[model samples]
Target: MVGKFTVVDGHVHTFASEEVSGKILTSFNKLYNIEFANPGTGTITDVLQNMDSVGIDFTIMANFAPAKIIHKNNSWSIEVGKKYEKLVPLVSFHPDMEEPMDILMEEYMRNGAKGIKFHPMAQGFDPDDNRLESVYKMSAEAAFPIVFHCGRVSNARLNNYADIDMIVPVIKKYPNIPFVLTHMADGNIGDVFKLADMFENVYFDTSIVITGYPPLLKVNEPSWPDNEVVEYVISKVGADRVIFGSDYPWGSPGHDLNRFMEMRIEDRQKSMILGENAIKIFKIKSSI
Candidate 1:
């Protein structure tokens, strides 16, 4: 875990709200007053410090900008990107906004955004909706990967296959846009594997899926072992398409770091899970 080999957390969040003032963990912990100081969310400094402690090199962090704050958050992320080399800023779109697809292509793409993060459940839109087709097309044109929040598999709040199936035609239509399905496409991972096989532009990141519990505690059962799930994803999608993601803030970074250390995956596979896969997928050249 020393030398140039360490974990790279791909998905992280910064609560850059006026209420929190971008102090990630401290503000959240203060709000909750938890003694452990390990509630997933952390300030940028906290995140960086935790990474150093755990041998994590970088964390690709993103912030949410609803319609009103979209411009400001985007600006803040750009400035934050300038300040923190380890924090790779990501752009997000809430389909509810006016002409969000057009805005993403024309304005935000020109900004320092490396990718697009969409949450259908939070945003209240179907991935397969005809309106989002234009947005997907714009992503293809921009060559920016779309990191989507895939819903659950069974008795889930969002139907996994149904939500993603809506976008199958888009994958077929835009064969070159790099689309990354996070969290192993919720629970219906087999269907996500099919998408990866069917679409050359698609990739899936192994995030909170490998981590044991929390938020998805009821969902992440004992039967779903980390080694088994990671092995299955690598087998189906190949090592290259599978990238590492801690899902920090919302996900348990410390617990996941421990689990990753404990997992039986080989050193080479672990390297792929940590950072190598992301290098290939995101075309990120230099190490952090």
Candidate 2:
């Protein structure tokens, strides 16, 4: 895999149908005024083919949906994981969902769910809400990693929901559970370092921040980090705590992996960020 290195995309979004995937892309395009990259239509078939193209041995499914349909979305994710060994599913949770957190956790964990994904902005819940205490407790007890869509989202109005300060309490309360702040905390480099320094269990995922969506290159907005910035983050956070993620359907796995592989970091560091750290953090049984 990738010439002596096992590669795992630690963060990816998948949809059960292309219609849903297209709607998501459309929404993002409208919100950001940019045509986000669509590497594989967010379907399992497309994701598998994209992974094969880049030698991505495994990918953590970090799909999230509206509260009304979260159960169905997560159920699809779990079933997909069972059917496809290479796809590891992380179920989603929203405090507003009718089903209690305990019931959802029991069902999801029993059905082979690897972890949890929380998009506070998309799910419309504050990360530090009192309602999420049980979620944190269960995750800590089970040592299940929780991936958060940290930093700004396309809708600036909802950015406050995922602010780094909002999740600090939960991170402090559950020191044992792994908390992966995706998008390199959305390029909040100082805050990223502060969290990494303070909490040993806190990790970062390099998704859109490592290599910006290709389509956005012509846009005036700041997108991804330069090579120097990427290397600086790796040095500051250590490769052991940074994981590779394509943010597929929005960012291409092939392009992101190529950009990542070209970084000046050492081979061991690359190996760790590309796959080893993911296996250790997610408890993925590597077939590579």
Candidate 3:
């Protein structure tokens, strides 16, 4: 535990330099206004370093794989997840990929994946695709939570795939599937709150919302989801459903933790957002 709280970073990405698509890299550049060499951003070693520094006890890490590279990315993620006790593996899948169902099943049933992650912007797909129905159904049956990249990228066109309107059917139909909306649906925070109100299984994470740079960098750029928005999300959704996530490299866990701590929320609420909610929702068997 991080002092008085059980800190869990509920969202994180781990990909080889080659696996990050140009589009995803470009989007990251736009969000942070920095020309990032995708590979320069920390790797497993960096992730561990940052988590240790920030007092993050655990982190839920996922792989972002497109249709053509799911196998490679998933295999790589399994290797990394197995090596780190603090890193909880959240596997990936592609609806168009051959044998995706089989891969998904094996990842969970054999590899011990704690959850699933879908990055429509990075992987190129729509969150509302009918093809995902079977996947959702399967997850619902297993009671496995899927944290989807909700909302659009900063300068990308595939954002429609994560549209809040499109999220309705997938979420409504699969009541049992715990859906953690990533990026707070991008900018559609209002609609996100509605979904949370409609479905108990719906959840939100604070990652790459305001800023991505660590407090040390102090990039001096405008924060996207500013304090007002953060306050609105917290007051409206309450703390139990808000998960702590730093889109590391893309966003800093250290900065994100500091930002959340500065908010005018209660300590108990902060504790839940830090980790307890994630543990309960994701069924993590962490001692914290």
Backbone clashes, each candidate: 3, 0, 1
Reference-based lDDT, each prediction: 0.64, 0.84, 0.73
lDDT of 2 at 165: 85
Compute the lDDT of residue 211 as modeled in candidate 3.
50
Worst 10 residues of 3 by lDDT: 214-223
For candidate 2, report its TM-score.
Answer: 0.95
lDDT of 3 by residue, 1-288 (tens): 566888998887765553454456666677635544432254677778778888999889866677877766777777777888788888777778876575466556477677889877667676767776777777888888999887654434544666666667788888998889877666466676777789998888877665545441343232354676777778898888888887766677776777777878889998999999888877777865
Consecutive 10-residue window with the lowest summed lDDT within model 2: 216-225
Better of 1 and 3 by lDDT: 3
Q: Could you tell me which 10 consecutive residues in candidate 1 have the lowest summed lDDT?
A: 153-162
- Of the candidates numbered 1 and 2, which has the greater lDDT value? 2
Off by over 4 Å in 3: 17-40, 210-229
Candidate achieving higher lDDT, 2 or 3:
2
Cα-lDDT of candidate 3: 0.73
TM-score per candidate, in order?
0.79, 0.95, 0.85
Q: Which model scores highest in lDDT? A: 2
